[model samples]
Target: MNITRFFIQGNEACARGAIKAGCKFFAGYPITPSTEVAEDAAIILPKEGGTFIQMEDEISALGAVIGAAWAGVKGMTATSGPGFSLMQEHIGYAAMTETPLVIVDVQRGSPSTAQPTMASQSDMMQARWGSHGDYEIIALVPSSVQECFDFTVEAFNLAEKYRVPVIVLSDEIIGHMREKINIPDKVEIIARKMPEEGPETFLPYKAEPDGVSPMPPFGAGYKIHVTGLTHDERGYPDASNPETHTKLVKRLCNKILNHRGELTRVKELYTEDADIIVVSYGAPSRSAITAVKNAREKGIKAGHIKLEIVWPFPEEIIRSAAQQASDIIVAEMNLGQMVYEVERVVKSDAEVSLLPKIGGQIHRPEEFLEMIYKCQK
Candidate 1:
């Protein structure tokens, strides 16, 4: 119940935040721009009487987190692009099993082993669809060291509340940046719900009106039969049955999609009566905000939206902003990955376009201002 100030890097902030959020377990393999998360966890978790393990690889890293969560501990893992690529199948499995876990991806540039120490928002799309399945994930973007702390806590909260993996989508810039984080007195921490009934009455995947089933961790003993195969309410593999598979998959997608109104959030500035809108997130958002302010001083009706919730995207908000603008300029540290997403939701006379800056750095504020000026033209 006391406020504190700490100047630290985003990765350290994320580690501290995970601890504050009551994360009791961390499983990870060291990767550039994100290894500090595991490093910090190693120091802090043991003090909290928690568990920290360095797995053989990124796949086992996530696997350990999943197994720990099933054992009833709040669990997390961190990695960069290459490591993230290895965790995809397990990400889908967490979604399928409705496991509560937090994953932090400090994005680097490109396909394989590209720019390990550099920054890129190239993984924004991957955060949502990296796994080879049709399921939704909650992805959060942190623009500053403070948000790195706050959003890591938020990721765990969302994961436990919704029974799904929540991704903390960071870039090397945000992960490595050192800044002051105002540690709050005490923040909210949410834990997963456990079954309230006897073992005989327990149903692992029962269809609830809310579409979330309470979980009973291992040794709590409600007939734990967790698996990757499509299962029914009873937690038995029913993959051979077409109906069971369809029901399970649809339920996984709907739980997040149906409640997106409550799940999605964004940061908006000067967007109400603007003629042009610059949509940006993560590190690029810092420049976008400054450029928007400078654009206003020059008498241009320019606004910006800093996307905080990337997946289960703030479609409603984007659609509304696009309708009120003359053009929408999407900016990011990648070659137009998120621009396509913006295009899908916008229905304005405002044409949507992308301002990409790849190869390790972020878009300069002046660079964004130039695109803003051109988009309105």
Candidate 2:
């Protein structure tokens, strides 16, 4: 078997992963930390028989991606905090329409672009509830360059499978970092399920028991109605009907939430007999995991839970860890976003504390160790 290896930036790996996952359309606006994802997509996509377009802004970039998805091609876009904020409306649009596309947000210090070239995980909550209406979306966080590739592939697969927008929640640190990663020649590719019936008999939003409808491409002779308003199974706008709105919205959220067991992905170490657990995601996990390892070396019963899939937030994992551990330390590059979810889930089962690092820096290993020691005390 021929093996390929390359030492590349996380952004470049993400582009390559999208290409591998059958992403044939990329529409994006350049922003710091995430610009290289579009840069590499521009360089690699054409060679792979794909199209790359730089839209006027983040809104149109995602608009183009949503357009491409309806046209039967896998689509993707990448951006940072401000751009991500711009794409929120379209994110909701994609959810209401059940359009399958991948969005990569290489987060930076924010509010209003506080730090462009620095790292942050402050976008965690935004990724979950950024849009106006209620909907569920899948988000994957990659700690290493290898996961940058792997999770991008997974993001596309999940998007196509669930017929929802999937976000790659990368930060500046992982987006710009360089490392060697193995490129497997063949990766499992999952395409959207097409309708079995003819176009005349199709109901575009009619779903199976799993709450996911079969998506038919635009040119596939299917006359489909796609809209952002409350839509029925026929995809027609029924904005005034309360029942239609409730059913549509619930399915939009539950299509992902109901499959929580399948969507939640985390990496655990030393959790079996741990007294303290450090929970983290994105770039902060890199430090949190190391600290847990060092704590173990010092005879501390510390464990680590690295969140690979950030949303539909992994409640069960934290709850189980809380049951086994006396204290849980939540490490993140923000002022306590996901820690709140951890606290909510753990809720008196275990003492939950936040170990936050903001303003463009990540938590150091020693900081996590100190927190673990403090928790122990």
Clashes in predicted model 1: 0
Please write out the lDDT profile of model 2 over residues 1-377, one tens digit for every residue.
Answer: 45599999999999999999999999999899899999999999999999999999999999999999999999999999999999999999998899999999999998797999999998999999999978999999999999999999999999989999999999999999999999998788998889999988889888889999899988888978888888888988999999999998998889888999998899999999999999999888888888999999999999999999989999999999999999999998988899889988998999999998888988999999999999999
Candidate 1: residue 209 Cα off by (Å): 1.1
Q: Which 10 successive residues of model 2 have the least lDDT summed?
A: 1-10
Worst 10 residues of 1 by lDDT: 341-350
The TM-score of candidate 2 is: 0.99
Local accuracy of candidate 1 as per-residue lDDT tens digits, 1-377:
78899999999999999999999999999999899999999999999999999999999999999999998899999999999999999999999999999999999987799799999998888888889989989999999999999999999999988899999998899999999889886789987887888789888899568999999889986767998998988899988999999999999999999998988789999998999999999999998899999999999999999999888888898888877897999998989888888998885556998899999998889998888878766
Residue-level lDDT for 16 in candidate 2:
93
